[model samples]
Target: MAKKKTTQDPALAQNRKARFNYAIEDTLEAGVVLTGTEIKSVRAGQITIGDGFVTINGGQAILTNVHIAPYENGNQFNVDPLRNRVLLLHKKQIVRLAVEAKEAGVTIVPLKVYLKHGFAKVLLGIGRGKKQYDKRQSIKKRDQERDLNRRFKN
Candidate 1:
């Protein structure tokens, strides 16, 4: 049988610092609710998930602090760039995330934004804040790995 073609969506924005700041324990994909202008801006790759985070309130998941630049042609229709947007997730999933988020030092952070099947989605990560010592250890381990790779390639 001929294999069906599968194409992954292109990433619009990513929070590169999240990995260095937190230890992610789990991840899930969630749909984003966006305005017309916001969607246009996201498709144009004018979005930033760096400071964005997810919160579960009243049994709903909401994404906050993400910046989606206004569409050049949107003019008066453009909404606030940092407005909180709703994230679509199952009731069970929302409850689970809420429980996890309630734990001390645990948070729901947006790792990346992308378009999938014509809809915008956010990669939500369940993470625990890393200590300063953990960050230093991670950096040191990464450097050692790089050095080992270089030595082996020679």
Candidate 2:
């Protein structure tokens, strides 16, 4: 069989743990406000979003704890690697997310970061944290799928 091809670009950073730990209710795309050096680093795939999350403070969306490595040659222009960056989301979206996030065990997390139309964008997911038992169930389901795949292949 021929290999499949996709037009979408690979994500610069992804929070792989987010999907496993949270039961995502909704997902939306939002633009990221990055400085010159930060954008460069992102394009070069020097970012980590595993520990990053979104917060609505002062009616603005902020991306916190994401690390964009400094551009090698951007000496004076490079800012803090882990500085909080703003997310360019509409007022209505911000209000919705803020309200949802306030519910017990619900939160906003950065699911992925990718470049679109030459601009950096984040895939934010509004999710509720999963309990330990739910995680075990997820693992079991995944294992069953893998085993079934192997049996069919053989």
Highest lDDT, which number?
2
C-alpha TM-score for every candidate: 0.94, 0.94
Off by over 4 Å in 2: 1-7
Error at 12, model 1, angstroms: 1.3
lDDT of each: 0.92, 0.94
Clashes of 1: 0
- For residues 1-154, what per-residue lDDT tens digits would candidate 1 score against the true structure? 9988656577888898999999999999999999999999999999989888888878899999889999999999999999999999999999999999999999899998898878999999999999999999999999999999999999
TM-score computed on alpha carbons, candidate 2? 0.94
Could you tell me the lDDT of residue 30 within candidate 2?
A: 97
**Poorest lDDT segment (10 consecutive residues) of candidate 2:** 3-12
Per-residue lDDT, model 2, residue 63, is 95
For residues 1-154, could you state the per-residue lDDT of candidate 2 as single tens digits? 9987665578988898999999999999999999999999999999999999998899999999999999999999999999999999999999999989899999899999998878999999999999999999999999999999999999
